[model samples]
Target: MVNNNEKDKSSQVTEFSKEAGYYLQKGVHCLNRSQLKKALKYFRKTIETDPHNTYTHYNIAYILSRIDYLKDINETFQEILGTTYNLPEASFLAAIYYSLTGEMDLAEKELEKFLEIAPEGEIMEEAREMLNLLSGEEEIYENLSYIKLSEKYEGVIQTVKEKVKRNLECPFFRVKMLENLYQLDDDLTSNIIFLYGLAENSTIAERVLRHFIKSSWAKEMHKELAMLALRDIGAEEPYEVMMENRIVKVTLKEYFERIPQWEPQWYQVMEKALENIKYNKYHSKTMEGELKEVWNQYIKVAYPEIPPVRDINLWSAALEYLTFKKRGINLNHKEISLKYRVFPEELLEKYKEMGQALSR
Candidate 1:
């Protein structure tokens, strides 16, 4: 007969295994619901119980890459694949890593290997498309030259179009390419706004705008999109473009009805003008009249109760900072402005040359 101690140990092992399975299932449920944080907690519990589970390791790696915390990711990918060389998820993820790091040929090979194993799943379709993109057999993005973007980087724009066509699921990649296109000429960026407006998917348009909103041009486009969404969707509103940036509670009819009015409670055409003026405060002839008019009128009514210029400045500055970051520019205006007494004008001017030329 087994000793009591050995029996107890065996029982404990069974209990731990059961608990690990429970948490793994819970984690999957959370992932299905898009509760990534909760999913991660459950996954972590599973890891603590079954440290050697390669499938668990693969799940963790996939989540990590999605959140963009890919430090030592190469090693993690290696660990997962090293444990289970034939795992489809492991191969697909490894291919993605390779694609991002410029290992196109390796990425294609890994994806092809994955398709060979699981050729019927949705994942297989994605892998096949990625393979086409990596091999340059099909362009990644659709050519949007008909949209009338700037001509300066026609070649790069074509490349971007190819990338977009190939990987429709990767919002980050699409946004990145649009950014590169915009840098070559602001006119192209402006045209992107128009192109994006024509997009059937709001998520895609949002990605395009979010990628570039820090720039004056992109912000201008976003304001346009916001208006389009408002007008097209018929959002209810009291229609105040608050001195505050946050969308205040309002009605759709009110917003539409007030667009042409000059009443103190509502601002319509002036919203875009003022937004432009905030960044381009030291304006050229184009912005001077409008800025001065809004500044003079707005401060008179909202003085003492108004939010500080510093607040507005900081907000716009934060946006500018985000744009610069997206472009791989190192300057952080918030810190610089606080520490050395720098101004938006200087930074604005630097980007303006690039920002203004995006489109005509």
Candidate 2:
């Protein structure tokens, strides 16, 4: 026969289970309400007894991120990564954490692995979008690193040539490697002209020139190459390619006498390049608070009549903010609220001043 005391004890245990379950549900509700602190307390209590609950682990991670507890966030992510429990949730959260902490390689690996396991993950759409953005950023960094490495090592061209022969096509590495070569070797100018003109795979060369023209050294190299290939070789067709592709700035026009054979098409491309440069120059110039003061007066005079539009102020604010503040925009748009409305000249000037101060 069951003893009355043992029955009472069993009842007490059942009541405790009910209490714990209630608290766990309430904790989740609190998190949904953005009551981070209240949610944290209940979650902590539930996790203390039910340590293996995957939902509890995921929720703690979310709340930790909200409160900006980076160390805790990373630790929680490590835990999520370890779990054989709830893979889709684990991977999705793990990817986010890895990305936030700038462990992009790890994040990418986790995301890819996640897709393999759960191709249609619960957050698959969001995961794909985030993956696209993160991978793009990784590609940029990888490309930059490759450029730097190629610049550092003289043997990079041979290495790339070998890779190309092996049918290894890393667009990022190839494009940057070509750029480094163009900067270091004048002989590469002919190669550059040929690559841009006659090669079937001209996209890499095109990208190289796009990145090259941004730097003074590369821009000068491009000009030199243009003069050599266009004047000495009398390759009017290639010159047309340069101009048509906007391979270099329009300022190179002064170097040539009669335009290339395809003068009409060439001039048209130059016109487009000049227009883009002009538009960008206007934004940089009119944004009176941009950190680059060298071009400030030139731009101001160049577009004297152009109004100080909201875009101009925004561009100025963005440049100064990025250059000086080094702030990251991970938080909600409303929380970091940058006003995008139009402002009068007086207001614009005030904002510019504010930007300048923030820049300093």
Candidate 3:
């Protein structure tokens, strides 16, 4: 009874539906293996192949809900909530999405709706947990049938601890943990690190961060956190940071003192020594910068009580030795002493002073 054109259109629609089903199956398979990127790609194919199938969109949001590290599905959440009423889980996804975006009121409403509609589902407990976290009665993250979030945050915590003990050249996440912590979900901060922040005893933590700031290896946040650490302890009103990017100044109720300054002659003699050993020519800026940082840090600790610049060539030799030691690059003292035409014991004496000052 139908025309050939109508028949062709019907055939094409059926084929597209089959293709969408195939992509949906493949996407779920990848998701079971924790391959989020691949799953998202296949899910996108399903959407593109069957644009009229609104349930496909809901499925995507439902699967991805509360995974805050992933990108937000803002309009998708709104569309599923406003227009699509069949899937109660759309409300669940909306709750997590809104919470991540800092709309606590909207998140609470969505969670309330989700709890009312979906009394029994895979994520019913997760929804309840989220509601509790929003009320400040508990933390937001939950253990689910699929993803174990507690283990994941626990892993990040372990790696961060090892890195803290090993190198002061910290990654950005560590700095984020120390600052702007309220922006993060609760599971991320459930450790001694957050405890220190709460106790306002960032003394040991701040000392380590100060070393990071003074090191040549300091990144941008390292510089900023050093100043903020001062404010946290009721230390100083105005602090000067050596690294100049954009200037920022804030006062916190804490205690701190001004940082120490090194004599310019120390750097000049160190550069001359670096040239003597052909160190500057090989790694010119690195050799100079590292020596300057080590010299200044020792000065910071032992300032006013620091020794006078006598027989600066001997001190230059010691400065070069200390810089290498700070980097965990061992240089033979006898070898370094000879290179600077200084006696080994005299260089050792100066080097010992530098090391002892930092240990304080």
Candidate 4:
């Protein structure tokens, strides 16, 4: 015969457990969908309801680690460590985080603790491999170079190339090829672009340009070249906003001047140039000859002693130097002088005067 008070407490505990399980399931569902914020909210509610839930703690730490929220991640892992409950899995995950961040000493400590407490399972094998690598007992690099590794994956490369050649317009195929080649070698990655350039498929070029702009791995030079290729084909207007934000006026001036006055692409080039010039008032002179005259008149009015240069290239380069300096960039006047065929002393003097006026 159990007491009534004990029965009531047992019922309340069971209800709370069920509610915690429900929230945990919801959190896992949101996490799988990559709704990290929502998942974190649900996980927090679960923690509030069931303070002893190790799985929820692990999930919270995992999400925090993935997002690189290091402060919160460290606190959460520390909380897990302080718990009396055995969570060897948490130690394993901490080891991985430390290893990725190059904290080899902390990683080794965590890995050793994980191996000491973790139950025998598939993770044991993984833990052993990590320990061996950390201890320098195993040579992690059997091949050493991507070149040698690429030979083993030649079939994968050929398949991607075949798919790309079969349907040059298929962005999926091109993106897949780029991904595969990028993993293999830098030369292979460049080869994909070279092949596309030779084909002169404007559509393919546009797709590749957008892909490069969005990719984290693509260098600034790659993005610039992609934009230049698009500009050459007059497909640049679609990316006008991105171009306006990223490209320097000197580069934009060259792009607009080099645009061919042909039948199909002329309007696109003119429209893109006009739109960009309107948005970036500083580059109005670079885009339109009439605007350049107006700018010279304004400069003559403001500074009567400093006469404008007759050479458009030198003027443009000077403007670029001024803009660069205004943005706190350290300018190499000698390099600019050699590149633009302007006297370094003259360029430096103009830059100093421009800096003074700008300061005022």
Question: How well is each residue in 1-360 modelled by candidate 2, as lDDT tens digits?
Answer: 999887766765554444455456555455445555555567556545444333343334433444444335555434434433444556655655555445677767877877788786555665565566665532222333222211211121223323332321565656554654555554444344433322223444444444444444544335444333233222333332243334443333442322211223322322332233333323332222223331233233333333343344344333333323332322222211233232344334543554455444
Which residue runs of candidate 3 sit more than 4 Å off their true CA positions?
A: 1-257, 280-288
How well does model 1 score by local distance difference test?
A: 0.47
Poorest 10 consecutive residues by lDDT, candidate 1: 148-157
Best by lDDT: 3
Check candidate 2 and list the clashing pairs. none
TM-scores for all candidates?
A: 0.28, 0.23, 0.30, 0.28
The numbered model that scores best in TM-score is 3
- lDDT by residue (tens digit), candidate 3, 1-360: 999888767766766776676567556555545556666667667766775543354345434443334444564344334434456766765665565445778878988998898788657776776677677684423221222222222112224234433332344534544553332433332222322222233455555434434444444333433444444444445443334343334332111123332366665676666666464223444454566557667776787797788787888888888877887778888988887889999999999988899899
lDDT of each: 0.47, 0.42, 0.55, 0.50
Model 1 bad stretches (over 4 Å): 1-70, 79-86, 143-360
- List, residue by residue over 1-360, the lDDT tens digit for candidate 4: 999787767766666666676566556555545555666666666667765443344334434445444236565445434442345655665665565445778878887987787657436766676767667675433221322211211121224334334556665655565664455444445444434433344566567655665555664334444554455445645453234345333343343333222232322323333343454434433234333333333353345444444554454445556654554556676766676677888777766665565454
Candidate 1 TM-score to native = 0.28
> Sorted on lDDT, highest at the top, how do the candidates line up?
3, 4, 1, 2
RMSD of each: 24.3, 25.1, 23.6, 24.7
Select the stronger candidate by TM-score from 1 and 3. Answer: 3
